[model samples]
Target: MSETSAGRAPEDAAGPAAPAGPPGAPAATLPYEAIRAIPVRHYGRWAAAVVVVALLGALAYGFSQGKIIWNTVGTKLFDHTVVTGVWHTVLISVCAMAMGLVLGVLFAVMRLSKNPVTGAVAWAYIWFFRGTPVYVQLLMWFNLSLIFQTINLMPFYKNDTVAVMTPFVAALLGLGLNEGAYMAEIVRAGIQSVDPGQTEAAHALGMTGAKTMRRIVLPQAMRVIIPPTGNEFINMLKTSSLVSVVQYSELLRATSDIGISSNAIMEMYFVASVWYLVLTSVFSVGQFYLERRFARGSQRSLPQTPWQKVRTNLTTLRRPKVAR
Candidate 1:
C-alpha cells in the first residue's frame, strides 16, 4: 500500500470518500430518472371486470324483453289499493322500529347490569325471541285470545279483551317485540365497540353513568350502530309482509288480491317487487348519508363523494403519458 507523509494508507489520504452526496441521498447513476412511476395494468382484473359487466348487461336485457305481462304491472303499480297498502307498510315499519329501539336500549342495559337476575332475564328474552321463527310468533300473537279470554287492566281501561287484541295491535306487538330482541343484540354489540377508556374517563370527570353513556359513549358507538340498524330497518320493511298472513292489507297482500282478481298473478307480484326495490333503494341512500355523518371522528379521512371520485378518475385518464 502507498503511504502518506504521516504513514497513513492511500484510502485515508482520500478522507472517507466525501460521503458521495447528502447523507440520505441515493448514489448517483446513469439513467438518472430510472425510478419512474408507471401505472400497473392488471390485465386479469380488467378482463374479469369486463366479463362481469357484460353478464349483468345481458341479464338486464333478458329481464326487460321477457314477456309475462308488463301492462298489468304498469296498471297495478299506481293503483289506489296498492298505494294504501304502501302507506300501511310504512306506518307499521315506523311504529315497530320505534318500539324496537326503545326496548332494545332497555334490554341491552339490563344485560350489561351488575345484577345477575336482570342479566338472566335479558338473556332469556333475547334467546326466546331469536330462537323462534318470526312467523310462528306472529301467528301466536294474532290468535292470543285463545289463551287469554280477558286482558284486564282496571286502572288503565274497562278490562275489555276485544279492544286490547285487534289484528293491528297483535301485528304491532309481534313485529316490535321480536325486533326488540334482535335490536338488543345489535345495541349491545355497538355499546361494546366503544373504548372502555372513554367510559372510565367520563367517570373520572364525575359524569353519571347515564350522562356518560348518552353524551360520549353512545355518540361514539353510533358509528358502529347506525349501519346495522339501517339494515334491520330494511329487513323490517320486508318482514312486514308476514303480517299479510293474518289478513293485514300490506303491499304484498293488496297486490296478491289484485292479481287474483285480474288473473295477472305474476305481473302484480312483479309490481310489488319493483315498489319494494324502490323503497329499499331510497333507504340505502339515506343510510349511506347517515353513516357518513357518524363516521367523522372514527375515520382518518372522509370518503370521497361520487363526483369527487369521478373527477379523480377523469384526471387520471387525462394524465400525459411519460416516455421511457
Candidate 2:
C-alpha cells in the first residue's frame, strides 16, 4: 500500500490522538465555561413593597397634618409623673407575673393530680377565672368592701377590707388571678409535651413524684413554658392599663391624668404609645435571650440574635463576587 494510505488506515483504526503536551508537563485540560444563572424577578414582592411604602408615607403625612401637640408629647415624655407611672407599671407587671406563675404551677400540678377532689378544684378555679373578663374582676376586687366590710384573720391579722384592698392590691389580684388561669393551661401543655418514658425512667430510678417533677420534668418542660410565659408577661404589661379603671395610677392612668390637666389628650396618648413600644421592645429582647438559654440541648443551632442577623446581612451585601 501507499505510505499515505497505510498511515491513514492506522490513524482511522486507532481513533484520533490527543494533542501533545510539552515535555515533563501534565496533560492539557479542556477550558471550563461557567454557567450564568439569572435569578427570578419577584414582581409581586416589589409591588407589595411599593404599596406598603406608599401607605406608610400617607400615614406619616396624615399624622403631621393632625392637631396633635408634638411639643406636649416631648415635654411630658420624661416628666416625674410619667416616670413614676412607668415604674408602677413595671412593678405591678412583675409582681402580677410572679404571682400568676406560682398559681399556674400549683394549679397545673393539681389539675394533673390523680385525686378527683384536687383535680376538680383546680378545674373549677381555671374555669371561673378564665371565663370572667379581667376588667370585671378588677371592679369586683375594688368594691369587695361593700360585700364584706372587714377581713378577719383572727389572731394572725385583721383589717377593714376597704383598707386592705387598695387600688394596687385590687389590680394585683385581678391581673394575677386572671393570668393564672391562662398560665395553667400553658404549663399543662408544656408538661404534657414531655415524654412519658422520661417520667417512667425517673420512677424506676427511685425518684418520688415530686422529686421527678422538680428535677427531671420541670427543667425540660421549662423550654416549652418559657416562650409563652414571656409572651404572657408582655401582654400583662399592656393589660395593666385596664387597672386604671379601678383607680390604680399605672402608666395609662398617669398619662390620662396629664392629658386632662394639659388639655393635650391626643398628644399624651402618643407619648403613652411610645413608652409602651419602648417597654415591650426591651422585654422582647430579654425574652429572646431567655429562649436562647433554654434552647441549648433542643436545637442544632440556636437562632441568631438581632445584632447577629444584621451583621450577617451586611456581610452578605458586602461580599465580593468571583468573575465567571
Candidate 3:
C-alpha cells in the first residue's frame, strides 16, 4: 500500500496498527533509584551507651561519698581474695564434672540394664536426687557429720572428736552427687539417640556388648552428650554459688567476704558478676564451637562464621524500633 509516487501514508503503517492492546502483557518496568537505595538505620543505638554512662556516674557519685577507696573494691579485686575464689570456682567445676561423669555412666548403665534390680536402684537414686533441691542436699551434707557422729576415712586418721566434714568436702559431695543424677539422664538420652542398627551391626561383627558400647555407641553418643555436657558445666559453675552457705571459699563466697570486709555490697557483687561473666563467656564460646562440631555430622552445610553471625546480629539491631 505504498503511495503511488504521492505523499500518502503506507497502508500497513496507517493508524499505528491498532495500538498494542490491553490483553497483551505489560512491558517490564525498570527498578526506580529510590527503591534500589538501601534503607538507613536511625541513631537510636545510644541505649546501651546511656546505661553505661549512668552506671559510671553512679559509681563516681558514690565514690564521692567517701565509702569507696583503696581499702574497698580496689584492694578486693587486686588482692588474693578474688584470685582464690576464681581458682576455687574452677576447681569445683572440674571436680564435680569429673565425679558426675563417673556416676553418670554408672547410673546410665544401671538405668539401661536388663536386670530389674539394677534399673530400680538407678531409678530410685535418680528420683531422690533429682526430686530434692540441691541447696537442701548441701544443707544435709553440712550436717551429715552430726548424723554420723564420728566418720571414718582411714584407720590412722580416724578422729577421736566428732568428725565434722569441712565445707569444701560437703560442697563437693553435694554438687557432685546432685550433678550425677541429672548427668545420668543426659547420658541415657545420648545413648538412646544412637541408631539401633549401629549396635546390631557391631554385634553382628562379633564384638562383645561392652566393647561395642565403649567403642561405637559411646562415640556417637558423645556427639549428643557433649553439647549438653558443656551447658551443664556452665550451669554447674553458677550453681557453685549455692556452696557459699556451707562456707566454701569459692568465688561467690570470696565476694561475700569482700563485701563484709569493705562494707561495699554493690561493688563486691559487681566484682562477682564480672568474674562470672568472664567464665560464662569462656564456657559459652566453647559450647558454641562444640555444638557446631556436633551439628556438622548431620548438617548439610558449614556453620556460619563468627563474622557472619555478627553481621546478622547487627542487621537485627539496625531494624527500626517498634512497640511490642
Candidate 4:
C-alpha cells in the first residue's frame, strides 16, 4: 500500500498542463474584417435640392424662350462703343485698386501705430470715407471746382480745378478713397490674425519694424488678406457702374448711350449684363486658383478636385461586400 501511494503521488505531481506552443510561433490571430460603412440618407436635404434644381431649370427655360429681342442684344454685344467702354472700366478699376492698395497699406500701418496722433488720423479717414455714400462722394469730387477753383502748387504749377478734376479723375478719387477705407480694415484684420510670437521673434533677431513687416509678417498675412481683397476687387468691378451717374462713360454709361439712341433699352441692358457676367465669371475662376495657391502651406490635406471627388465616390460605391 505504501509503494502504490508513492507511485500515485509522482503521477499527481506531473498533473496535466497547457500544451506548449512551437518556438517563437505567433499567437493565432482573427481574420481581418473592415468596419462596415453605413451611409446616412438625409431626406430633407434631397428634397430641398430637388426643389432648387427645378426652380433653376424653370428660370433658365424662361430666359431662353422669352419674347426678348435677342437680335438687338447680339448686335450690340460686340459693338465698338461697348468694347471701348469695357476698356475704360478696366482701366478705372485697375488704377483705383492700385491707389487703394497703397493707401490701404499705409493707413493700416498708421492705424496700428503706437503714436496716438497717427492712429487717430487713420481712424478719422476711415470713419469719414466709410460713413459717406460713394455716390455722394463721386458727386462732390466731380464738382470740386466750386470749392477750389484752382490747385496751387507754387513750386511746380497751378492748375484749374476743373481741368485737373475731369470725370475720369473724379471717378478714380471717389472709388480709390472709398476702397482704401474698407481695405484698411481688411489689412488690419489680416495683420492681427498672424501669431504674435512671429513679431516677437522678429524683434529678437534685431530686425527693424519695417523689415520685419515686409519679410516676415506680410508674407504670412497674405494668406488671410488675399481672399477678402479679391472679393473687394470683384465688387469694385461692379461698383464702377456707379461712375455712370457722374458721366464717366464706363461700361454701363456707354451701353446706356446705345440703348437710348437705338430705343432698345432692355436689349442693350441685357447685352451689358451678359458682359458683366462674363467678366465676373473670369475673375471668379482666377480668385479660386489664387486662393488654392496660397492655401497650400497652411492646410495639411488640400481640398480634393472635382475629378478626385468623383473617383472617390466611385470607389466607395464599388467597395467589396462581406458575407453576412
Best by lDDT: 2
Candidate 4 stretches with Cα past 4 Å from truth are: 1-49, 64-67, 305-324
Backbone clash pairs for candidate 2 read none
Question: Candidate 1 on 22-131: residue-level lDDT in tens?
Answer: 78998554233555668777789779989999999999899889877787788779999999999888888889999998999899989988999999999999999999
The lDDT, on a scale of 0 to 1, for candidate 4 is: 0.88
Per-residue CA lDDT of model 4 for 213-258, tens digit only, reads 9999888988999999999989999999999887899899999999
Q: Write the per-residue lDDT of candidate 3 for residues 107-187, one digit (tens) a residue.
A: 998999899999999999999999999999999998876667775678656652224578888889999999999999999
lDDT of 2 at 296: 98
Clashes of each: 0, 0, 0, 0
Ranked by lDDT from best down, the candidates are 2, 4, 1, 3
lDDT of each: 0.86, 0.92, 0.84, 0.88
Better of 2 and 3 by TM-score: 2
Q: What is the per-residue lDDT of model 2 for residues 254-297, given as tens digits with 9 covering 90 to 100?
A: 99999999898988899899999999999999999999999998
User: Which is the winner by TM-score between candidate 1 and candidate 3?
Assistant: 1
Candidates 1 and 2, the one with greater lDDT? 2
lDDT for position 287 in model 2? 99
Candidate 1, residue 174: the lDDT equals 89
